[model samples]
Target: MLIPLIALAGVLPAPALARGMDEPRASLMVGALLAFAAVLAALALLVQARRLRRRDMQLHARNAHLAAANAELREVTERAEAKARMLDGVLAAMADGILVVDAGLRLAGWNPRFPDYAGVPRRALRIGMPLREVIRLQAEAGEFGMVDPEAETERRMAMFHNGTAPQRLQRERPDGSRLELRRTPLPGGGYVTLYTPILAPAAAAAGDAMQAAFRQEWTSRIPRLTAAAADGDVAEARAVAHALRGVAANAGWTRAAAAMEGIEETAAAGALTQLRLLTAGLPQDPAAWN
Candidate 1:
């Protein structure tokens, strides 16, 4: 390109020579034209080099941003997986059967205890199965007992869907075991249901009566213990302490049993003052005894 331009300039100077020009003057003019062309070429090269450098910098910045974004995404994914594992651990350790359903009423997950508590066959529950389907299966298996299975299924499904349904309900199984069902709504949506076996009403009543009788017996012994303390009779105090400890143990009052043991040790050691002090701290409430 420079050769062609130089040739054209040379021709233009020939024309100038034909018009009129001395040799020394023509040589000076040609030299000046060549110098000006070199300056323009140098400036053009500098501009192109600057443009390439700027483009390289932009590409480097874009690559760095992409790497950073990928790292952040990986970290977020790992954290989510860890949280899911923690949740599973918690559910597995629970005694009651637990079921988690999504906002669409589809089964999301369940604990291992669910099948046993629901009286459903193992592996019968699957992810994405509708909650109504699980209820229908249970109803057909006589979990709701000899009633219209379809009707019971509809009733259960309605109650579960109804926002106003009771959070807790007690239902009896065909085998005579009672289960306490509790429903809890999730924060984002959907619900978690738990089924826990509970004692029958008659058994619970009997338990209450037994506790009352024991409390009465313990109360009757309190008078004797007081008299023994007043009389400073070590033998009587020791006997009363033993009896109280037995009563507390039977009632499953661990704190009360420990207290009684302390009294017994004092009496055995003949520390009447300490024995009386310990007795003074005894629980007065019958319920506290257990």
Candidate 2:
């Protein structure tokens, strides 16, 4: 409306000059100039308003995207926490001690049995602590005997760092309990150590007694048993071989048990040649029984 009024004023000024109205023409000219300035200012304000609206829309979009990303991050965190809790519960219920270290050789996780098997206090084995430190503490507690704790710790740490293969060994704790230790490496450059108590004093003593009785039985019986097999006495050979099988199996002599089973089978089948062949070298391989 103001633009059209200014155009009408421009046309009217020429007519006013033709009508010789000089004073009125001058006032009309000033009014037309003000209207034109107002129109320019109005256009500027409209352009600014459109730009503000567009910026507000962009801000809303960005905010929505941020909120979605935050929600996803929170969900992932919750899932990880749930899995961790499940793992913790499973480890706690296990009978053996489990200790896991990270790529940095720092303690990552453990079960309650760790402290018991390691002979170290629970407070001494903190998560994220260096495994060397834990070993030092156990050594100080006399788990490793009278050796220098620092040197022993360094030796153990070197095994992992130097790309050692998985190893299993049995060592005695100062508390009279024997533990079987197994160290396994992770594909991602870390290690896990498991400690399983192998025997109590009573169990070890009983085992020793059983082994002594088995050794005596083998010593007294094998010569006669072999002689009977060599003589083609199938009944006597089978009976003696069966008896030795039971004793060997009970005493954890896997190789000897297998040999005894072969002997029993040959005797039962009356294969005199195979029986004699098996008995021919029995005395020479006595270490197999031991």
Best by TM-score: 1
> What's the lDDT for all of these models?
0.78, 0.79
Worst 10 residues of 2 by lDDT: 281-290
The best candidate by lDDT is 2
Q: Write the per-residue lDDT of candidate 2 for residues 136-204, one digit (tens) a residue.
A: 888888898888888988887787688773479988889777889898888997788989778677977
Which residue pairs of candidate 2 clash?
none
Cα lDDT of model 1 by residue, 175-210, tens digit: 988899999999988988988879668878987897
Q: How far in Å is the alpha carbon of 177 misplaced in model 2?
A: 3.1
Structural similarity to truth (TM-score) of each candidate: 0.59, 0.53
* Model 1 residue 3 lDDT score: 54
RMSD of each: 18.0, 21.4
lDDT of 1 at 90: 49
